[model samples]
Target chain A: MPALPLDEAGKYVAGAYVVFVVLLAVYVAIMAAKLQRIERELRELARFAEQRNGERERERVTTDV
Target chain B: MYGKGLRTLSIATVAALAAALSLIFFYAPLDADQGFIQKIFYLHVPLSIVALLGFVAGGVYAILHLRSGERRWDAYSYVCIHLSVIFAVGVLITGSIWAKASWGHWWVWDEPTLVSFLIVFLLYATYYPFRYAIEDPERQARYASVFAVTAGAFVPLNFLAVRLAESLVHPRVFATTAGGLPGSMMLAFLVSIAAMALLWVTLVKLELTAKSASGQLKRLRRALDAPAPGAPSRVAPEV
Candidate 1:
């Protein structure tokens, strides 16, 4: 097979690399979304724990009084 | 635990990929036959090779899962296959592009290698629906391991059949005998393969860490006697 002219061959080569880069970027974006969900959940869990601690402290104080 | 050393691994992957790309463009000589179009070979072939190996690795992990009855092995198998499927997609698209550039068509049934790869891709594509169909988590994981092992065995056989199918049109680029690839091309190809392999590992680790974190969250919620927030994942088995 004869060598393809540089300009023509360049387009296809560039397209292939671009596809690869775009796929990686998309995967990174997905990981970011997952990280966000984890962060939100952790925050909620922390708040829940704090509220539970406060309830326990208030009940102890009332019992002592 | 999965996240440990992730930063270093990612940095190494980037460095290797940079080296591979530079070597591909600057170091490797233009092919006498295919010229600049041949540059696609470095990317396409390495990805195909790594993805195929990944499928087999998934199968191996599946075997371990089955032997030990451990869910972590199942998680490992699932992630390996999942990433490989993505890699396979890249392979097929890039392969098609290379084929079109070389053969003047988007697809051709005549090439056994291309057709066989397509068949393999199609078979793996059924995995998601198959897992989703079985609602029982234990049963689903077991069945999936069986599928992974069966499919893993199929990979090598498929490649052998394609290789033997008598097609002189597709150049065997890896023919490493007398009058085969020159040293520079071989070096660049090896570097590209290393880069792709590293990239695969880094992404797999990233995904496993995310899944692990999710699992930890569920454990914490159970300890706190809190309600589960989201609908359970149908396809991905939790560790």
Candidate 2:
């Protein structure tokens, strides 16, 4: 096939590159969301551990006193 | 462990990709046949190659999963397939754009390579539903591994069939090193392939790390007897 004129060909070339970049960006965004969820879960788990530790300490002090 | 070299991988990927783009635009000569539009070749072909290989890798991991009965291998297979599916979408879309630019149509029925690739993509597309359909985790992983291996085996056969179908008439400009291309074009092509491969590895590692984190979170919750956070993932096997 004969190549399209430079002006016309530019659009398709641009479109192809844009599609590639956009897809990569979308994948990165999805991963970012997953990372955010992981952070939240870690925070929740940390808080849960801290609460349990506090409760155990309180029980121990009460028994001693 | 998955994130161990992620930073270095990311840096190397960026460096390679930047070098590729520069070489593509500045170093590579305009094609006598396709001109600037041929630039798309650098992006499209590499992605196609990487995605195809990823499917095969997924199948390899699946085989390991089946042999060892290790859920981690299953997780690896799943992530590889998942990433490849995403890349496949880019392949089809970019390929369609290239086709439209070259042939004046968004799709062409007569092109064996294009058709074969589409077939491969369609075959892998069924993976999600297939996994979703089976409720048993162990059974699902086993069956999915089998499917991956079967599909992976089909890839090379499909390529061979396509080559045989149009070997003489349609010369493959896509395979840069196969003899026709100029040295500059070949260099850009190789660099692009390297970048795309690195990008694939980086993304796969990122995903596996994410899954590992999620799995650890689940383990923590179980240990603490903390009420389960939201519904568990139905399709994705936790590592």
Candidate 3:
């Protein structure tokens, strides 16, 4: 194959690099989504714990009365 | 603990990647024959090599998992294969681009190197579905490890077969008779490989950390008798 002119070859080279970067970006996006789900679940768990603690405290006050 | 040093590793990967890109574009001399188009080699070859190594590493972890009957090793094996498959996708796309630029075709079936790589990629691609097919967690993990070890062993044999095959289209840089890569090109290639390997390790650590956190959360839920939010994953082994 004949050597491609610099101007023409540049596009293909750029395209290859672009594809690599795009794949990395997509992977990052997926990871970010997973992290978000984890955070949401943690928040729910914390709220549940707080709710349970409040119920226990209310029961103690009624027994003292 | 899985996340320990993750920050340092991430910083190091970014630095190495920057150095590699600088060397590839500015330092490495252009190929006399392929010229600028050959730049893709630094990216494509390193990704392919690292991905192949990752598969092998996954197999090693699988062996450890089987011997110790530990779930952590299975998690490691899963992440290694997971990242490798992602890297494999990058390899195929970049390889196709390079092929088109050099040979005027996106794919050439006659080339053993290309076909063998595709075969390896396809084989690893089935891991997820094959793993999910088994309903029992213990059985699933055990069977997946066996699959990983078998596929991992096949990788090297496949590579060796391609190396021995006579091929006119693909360039063989490692052949001693071919005079190999020039010094500058070799330097760039080595650094690129290091960068990719570091990146792979960093991603694996990150994934394992996330899985660990999830596992801990499940433990907490069980201890507190909190209702589970959703069904557990059938494929991803608990860390």
Candidate 4:
């Protein structure tokens, strides 16, 4: 095969590299979404635990009274 | 534990990738045949090789899963195959681009190497549905491991078959008598492979760490008697 002119071949080379970069970006985006979900769940769980603790404290105060 | 040394690995991957890109563009001499287009060879070949090794690694993990009946092994196997499938996408897209630039066509079915790779990719593509089809978690994992192992074994055999076939289009780099690549090209190629392999390992670790965190949260939910915020994933094996 004859070598493509540098100007023409540059586009194909750039396209291939772009494809790679885009794939990596997509993967990173997916991982970010997962991290966000995990954070939201952690916050919810923390609030639930805090609310439970508050209720237990109120019950102990009433019993002491 | 999965996240341990992740930062170091990520740093190494970035450095290697930077060096590889520099070497490929600035240092490596242009090919006599393909010229600038041959640069794609560095990316396409490394991604393909690393992805193939990943599939084999997935099979090894599956073997461990079967022998030990351990869920962690299954999780490792799942991540391995998962990343490999993603990498395979890169391989196909880049391969097609290379083909179009070199052969004046986006695809050629006549090439054994290209067709065999597609076949392997198509077979692994079925893994997601095949895994989800089984409802029971234990059964799903066990069956998925079997699929991974079978497909993994097929990868090498397929490569061997392609290697033995008469090559009409695709350049057989390794089969060349004058040594596959010039020294500068070989150096760039080797660095690219290292970068890709490191990236693979780092991503695998990142994923496993995330899964571990999710698993821990599930354990906490159970202990606290709290409702789960959403439906559990049907396909992902837990850490």
Candidate 5:
């Protein structure tokens, strides 16, 4: 049943495999973006907390002085 | 063990998946009999097998969590089952395409591939609503564990039943798939299987990481929201 560019059957078969690979790539990209965002947020939170603690310590030292 | 090891494991899994997929497309020979269409079988079969494996892994861990009262085990189990369902849906679609190409029909009622996978999809469908219905988190996990274990048991039984049915009804035309595959093709199958397994692990880790991060973020935000006398950024919740 030879027909057209790659044979209808063959094209469909190849397409099936292609669909999976494409879906996988999309999934990885989503995960990567998510991971980056989460890490960035966590870092921001860490810095904020550290700065707050430092300010609190400074105030305590000033009162003692 | 798996709780803290996710990061390194995710990288290694991605590498393994890449290697396995390379072997699938590059090293595997074209089938002498089924031609290009048989190639789909390489992916479809492995994905189906791995989906079953995913459910079973979830079931096993669910049992552990229920017995030991470990939240980590419950989380792992839920993630496993969830990803497996997604992957299984992929397999079902691709397999239907393959079957249509080979048999001149979109689906076959008696096809072992069609029947068994249908059973699994239905079984997994029930899992979500069942999980959502329960109010107590641990108790919900406990019931879900039981259902997942039951589904895990049925998956193999359905597979076996389909095989037996094929033998009795369509003995000549529906012989086992193993007879058709050659050595190179077999290698491809094995590689595909490995790749799918690695992909499953990688995907699960990524999802779990996202969930854990969000959970931690929620806690951090709550703590930040509390009236810390020196904190400056309590104006609004972090977007």
Candidate 6:
């Protein structure tokens, strides 16, 4: 849909540049979401480990008392 | 702490991305030749360069791991290669769009730019299998590192070969903005690069975390599956 003589080449180039920005922005957003999800999962795992550790500590105190 | 690398990389990347966008949008001169489509050049070219750099990082880390016998180096190597792969995909997609407008094709084998990208893609595709083939962690890391190191050298060589084997139908990269582009445009371009690099590091860190978590999970499972300290004598007798 672009005409010749390189007059509109500038327009085409501009279009390409715009597309790049949009793509990059989208990519960053997706990565951010993925990172957030992974962090959430890690938090859950850490909590599980902490709970197990707490239970063991309680058992030790009961025996000592 | 994400450490200096992550922190600097993250901040720099975000900032660069912001700057790059602004430059391209507002400051950079409209191409004298390619016109509007030329704008894609700012994004497309930088991506290829970044992807190439990513592979180089992987390959270098791989060599270091092999020489030193450090398992951690292998982790870094794998991460670098992974980042390179992601960037490579970006290059291909953006390049294809650029090609369609310029050369009127979604795909072309002979274009040096396209050819370089494809070879890089193929090179990286094999990396994952190399990663997963061996069951032993140390062994897997050792062999994979060697492959990564070797692959890094070959990517450049392959790129050079493409140039030699066929004429570059596409425009020479970075030529447009190389000659005294306006200040704002320069800033935007730099910002984009920084943003991209940061984001790449973030992904690498994420992958590294996943790798470590999986390893720990395995250890936990092993501990659970192990037999109890005492014998089965907890039961009175075999009925």
Q: Name the regions of candidate 5 deviating beyond 4 angstroms.
A: A1-6, B1-27, B167-180, B216-239
DockQ of 4: 0.89
Candidate 5, A4-62: lDDT as tens digits = 23387667777787778776777779878867876877777788888889999999999
Docking class of 3: high
Write the number of the candidate with greater lDDT, choosing between 2 and 3.
Answer: 3
Give the TM-score (vs. native) of candidate 1.
0.97
Interface RMSD of 5: 4.6
| Positional deviation of residue B197's Cα in model 5 after best superposition, in angstroms | 1.4
What range of 10 consecutive residues in model 6 chain B has the weakest lDDT sum? B230-239
Candidate 2 ranges with C-alpha deviation above 4 Å: B167-171, B174-179
TM-score winner between candidates 2 and 4: 4
Better of 4 and 5 by TM-score: 4
Query: How many residue pairs clash (N, CA or C atoms closer than 3 angstroms) in each of the candidate models, in the order given?
Result: 0, 0, 0, 0, 0, 25
TM-score of chain A of each: 0.92, 0.95, 0.94, 0.95, 0.78, 0.70
Superposed model 3: Cα runs more than 4 Å off: B230-234
Docking class of 5: acceptable
lDDT winner between candidates 3 and 6: 3
Clashing pairs in 3: none
Compose the digit string of candidate 2's lDDT tens values, residues B1-239.
88999999999999999999999999999988888888998998899889999999999999999999999999999999999998999999988898888878898887788888999999999999999899999999999999999998998888779866844433485554556878899899999999999999999999999999988888888889997778667767877
Model 2 clashing residue pairs (backbone): none
Could you give the CAPRI-style class of model 4? high
Reproduced native contacts, each prediction: 0.66, 0.90, 0.76, 0.82, 0.48, 0.27
**DockQ, candidate 2, vs. native dimer:** 0.85
Better of 3 and 4 by DockQ: 4
What is residue B197's positional error in candidate 2, in angstroms? 0.5
lDDT of 3 by residue, A1-65 (tens): 98799999999999999999999999889888887888888899999999999999999999999
Model 3 per-residue lDDT tens digits across residues B1-239: 89999999999999999999999999999999999999999999999999999999999999999999898898899999999999999999999999999999999999999999999999999999999999988888999999999999999999989888878579876766856998999999999999999999999998898889888888888888899888665557778
